[model samples]
Target chain A: MNDEAACVLFDSGHRACGGCAAAMAARLILDAAGKDTIVVSSTGCMEVFSTPYPETAWGVPWIHSLFENNSAVASGVVASLKKQGRKEKVIALGGDGATFDIGMLCLSGAFERGHDFTYICYDNEAYMNTGIQRSGATPYDASTTTSPAGSCSFGNSRPKKDLPMILAAHGAPYVATASIAYPPDFKKKVEKAVNTPGPCYIQVHAPCCTGWGFEGEKTVAIGKLAIETGLWVNYEMENGVVTKVKKVVRKPVDDYLVGQKRFRHLFKPKRNDAEIAKIQALADRNAVKFGIDITLKK
Target chain B: MAIGTGCTARPGKSRNNKTGSWRVFRPEFINEKCTSCGMCRIICPEGCIGENEEGLPVPDYDYCKGCGLCAEECPSEAIEMKKEEK
Candidate 1:
């Protein structure tokens, strides 16, 4: 790798698909954490693709733990580092399946004990590693392998779990939601989480081009649309209190859902106005609940 | 080449695998139109794009899989993707 390319701790030339937002987020997080960092990844896309036996892409010290125990492993690493008086940052990386479902208990325990580490969940909204199955983080009415939209069904019937709020309920020092389209904001949150002296959680909205049924090049644009439509709100919380929220220009949720093939069934021969309206209501509720400013300034 | 788990001492053995042949489209950087914004370097999934002495982004084509992300995210439109000439 060249000098500039080597600056990022997450080395490239892995098996991630082109225009992968999760890959971009990983690079941003590593760049923010600097060299004195150790990463613990779960058994997911990030771990499987980045370290296939002998060929590892990470430049920093990295470890791969089981899908359900990365947070617990990271906690142990933090404890050992603390005992040795080392100041290296410990980051637990996982996808939504590991974070919101399988690993929730260990993550809660880690946060409850207030381990000095950062936990980043690359929320692609489903289990992309397992052929795009539905997870607890999958959005409502979105199609997935397990939650297919057929004649008798409309995809996932349950809403995405409010994981950040649950983490905040543990009294985490820092909690934030970010999207890959806003790199500066994402990097700043990562830096802040690493610098803070307790457990921190940052959930990043990483668009999955292949699983989400969008063109590869539209990853960034899709991420932006998610934020613009209030479908994915970006905000920060410190000590269980909301601090910052990214304002939106208030596009309809249809604008965000129409592009993805996952939502294609909702707009096939005719637009599912009722389902679209329900999705819109969810976004509107989020805008109001999070106090997202929808005012457009000239 | 069959090494036991936790026995192999050598790291990064996959460096021998050249992945450039996976490209369906290749990025062509236009020097004059380049503003050196460095966005392409930051956003490249493969991290194959680096800065030269002039601080312009240059792709190490040997590993670049022609993701076309550089072309898509470039504000200056300095990079264009052309069909790979097989």
Candidate 2:
């Protein structure tokens, strides 16, 4: 493998469809973490794509457990390492399906217990691995297999569950949301979390090419647009207070919705601007609630 | 890859043509029936399919995961899928 290829976490022999953004996210993350990291991946795309019996692509100490217990297992690793006086960093990565929906309980328990690990949620907004099913992190008015948008209902009517808020409620030392589009910011967050004292949670926005119905190369662009439009906010809470904001002023969320097929249902003729507006309002609420420090472009 | 945005975002990852879990299948474009409409390239979810120097749609099989999405979404039935042995 060339030096450039060394950054990838998932390699050949895994079963990810063409244009898998989660795979890209996994690679970007591993690149940021460098080599001194042991990843505990929940039952999701990263685990499915990196480890398939005799043929494995993961270049680090990786473990694949049940869908909801990655955090618990990570806690175990942290405890064992602490007992052994090992200083290496441990990261637990999970998908939105695992993190926001099924694994939420275990994650909460891990955080509340103050495990010395960093839990990064590669949030693609749905269960992309299981045929594009809707998960708790899916945005409102976005169509999925479960939440079909039609004349009556636009899409997922219920807003995405506030995951970072929930993690913050656990009183964890650090809680932040990031996107793969912003590499510098993402890398910085990972470095910060690794160096920080207690448990840290970073929810990184990962766009799904097939599931979201966008061009594969636009994965990074779409992910960046998510944060730029405030559809997804990047912020961190330090010691229970929302102290640092990643991006201040957000673009209109429509730029993001138009790029994906999942939200295509809203672009019809007799359109539901109210639903779109409601989604924007939710983003605005996040800005206000989190007190984002918008940075003005010079 | 052309960088269209701020500061020319540096490219990441290896374009190493390693055939592992994912491999891109080359699209056999029938120039006779091809209307040059660009649907195959447009609908390519991977965006790895694009016009060559001759303006003919070509698939970058190195990154293509053989998803056959091009053949599935082809409008004119001009693109045929051929699976290559890894």
Candidate 3:
């Protein structure tokens, strides 16, 4: 689909935040899948906000399934299509909470069964739909409603789950990590996933303006910072083998974290260099693992 | 409208819910400074901006929620955000 047509598929009249990364990602995903696609969305912010009672923004055949069963629903749809000898593509959509936490079991089962579908997880880092609570996808030291930073506690103590790698381990035909900062790269990955056979998983680093505590206009900028800092590495794995990686221009993690209110505690009153360093180390490790050239140029 | 488990309205019913009232700041387009790059129209959250005969963006203020995204992403600074006079 072209740019103009893509915009029409995911109507902007829906109630998304001023600069919603998930909304943009949805448009890109649907555009890649084209009109002959069936979308299955899990119960989350995207589902609730897009399809309120007596209104819908989606222009395709969309279904709202339980939070933990969207993948199962997509699998069923794929199976039905195959039985009927149809060529319609099935795309399963879910937020980080649903994909990494609630719906992980069903997703794993679908992947194991080698279902012909694409599961896209919009990783906004927390359970924004449930009032910004901490989830398995929340990065380390990030503050959330459930993981508030206090005198003794330092927000969320654990790191983000390696979701794409886990999906790759399942021997998915295609697995990728994408960011909303790069629209062309994201669009290409979605299209590739849609056309690839068997189970494909694409995790998109979607930033939430309200939940992440960033200015509405800074949504795309924040997403770029995440990629540049190597905190959100972009890579693709095919059949359990790494095939592609987006090299980062290496920046300190502080540049990415200091913009969002969720990480405000790390800089105010007294700068927690130790915590910041730990996060930076995580970025460094990610760059190395993904073969991203982070070497600073003189 | 009765609340249900799924979407009940005919598709595209969201167009009926004019969200312009939600805006606290409105984006004013400066046609002279615009290069007709269409970046604002592409990044606009409302997708209410359209090009006129001159290729300058003309926003449908009745549905725009004053997101200011157009002003922020505008490469030429052709769009400026002005506080709405409630």
Candidate 4:
């Protein structure tokens, strides 16, 4: 075992799939947060893979409670730290299932009380741990095991829940949405969230290969496409004000949808133009809301 | 590895499971064409690529799952994915 190789906070050899975006997100989060951090992970894919039984990939102090109570756990940790006069940074990590569906109450309560901790949700869009179930973060019209698109069904009908905006509504000191494709941006956001004094929220768009039906190597590219198409926006919100946004000359949502198998039904058996247009409209709304469209000077 | 009372395990012990055997295509780091840009080290999902003394990327194959992310994201085209045998 090389000594310097151990320098990486999130060590390899964990059971995360090849080119797993959650794994990459974990590495980047620890890289930004450093060793003097306590990670309270909710029961999710990361918890399942990184710490199965007795093994763990985390190089920092880590803890795992129930799926719906990690934010609550972090709240307790924050309160305990305050009592002990400890300065260690508290980061509560969860997937979209835990963040959007199961743990929303705990998350809201923690932020409402203004706990000095950072809650980072790696949104892979669905529950990839328990066999690709439909999650609240699932994009509009994307197929999953539970919400399979067939002759009658058009997959998950609801658009991704605006989690960052919801967290920002809690008067968080800082809130940001990021993607795994932009590592530097993500690292910077994590650093900012950890260093800030009040409760912070960061929702990272981590593309899952096994769930999304893309090749493992195309994880970063898929994530990039999501942003390039305006389906996923990368922006920072500080005290309910938009401070920064990653603007791009938007591409058609078709370019992003065509790559993933989840959206295969949209293209196959003659193009579902009407349905596709609705998804495109969602992206257009995001562009208009964030004003992320950058007109390239020809 | 003795876990302490009430399921307290050692930090970073996932190293016990060597994931190298899971690779179908192995990435070969080509030092000749390498610019030492360190992009491969930063972008690797496995986090197995470490820098050698000369600042070139060296992959710890014991844990590298050969996702070819480094090869795909390499700006200098220094890393190549070769078919693995046995």
Docking class of 3: acceptable
lDDT of 2 by residue, A68-165 (tens): 89899999999999999998799999999999989888998999899999999988888887888899989888899888877677878788888888
Model 2: CA > 4 A from native: A1-5, A8-14, A290-298, B1-86
Candidate lDDT scores, in order, read 0.89, 0.74, 0.87, 0.90
Per-residue accuracy of model 4 over A1-298 as CA lDDT, tens digit each: 2224334578887899999999989888888888789999999999999986677788888899888999999999999999999999999999999999999999999999999999999999999999999999999898999999999899998888988999999999999999999988999999999999999999999999999998888899999999999999999999999999999999999999999999999999878999999999999999999999998789
Tens-digit lDDT track for model 1 on A120-221?
Answer: 999999999889999999999999999999899889999999999999999998999999898889989999999999999999999999899997788888
**What local lDDT score does residue B83 receive in model 4, on the 0 to 100 scale?**
97
RMSD of each: 2.1, 11.2, 2.5, 2.3
> For residues A1-298, what per-residue lDDT tens digits would candidate 3 score against the true structure?
2556666677657787777778778877876789888999999989987777667777888999998999999999999999999999999999999999999999999999999999999999999988999999999999999999999878999999998889888889899999877777898999999999999999999999999898888877888899889898888998989898989778889899999999999999988999999999999898888878756769
Top-lDDT candidate index: 4
Per-residue lDDT for B1-86 in model 4, tens only? 76677765453388889999999999998899999887777777888888888989889999889888888888888889999999
With candidate 3 superimposed using the best TM-score fit, by how many Å does residue A141's alpha carbon deviate from the native?
Answer: 0.5
> Would you list the rank order by lDDT, best first?
4, 1, 3, 2
Location of the lowest summed lDDT over 10 successive residues in candidate 2 chain A: A1-10
Candidate order by DockQ, highest to lowest? 4, 1, 3, 2
- Model 1 is docked with a DockQ of 0.54
Q: For candidate 2, what is the DockQ-based docking class?
A: incorrect
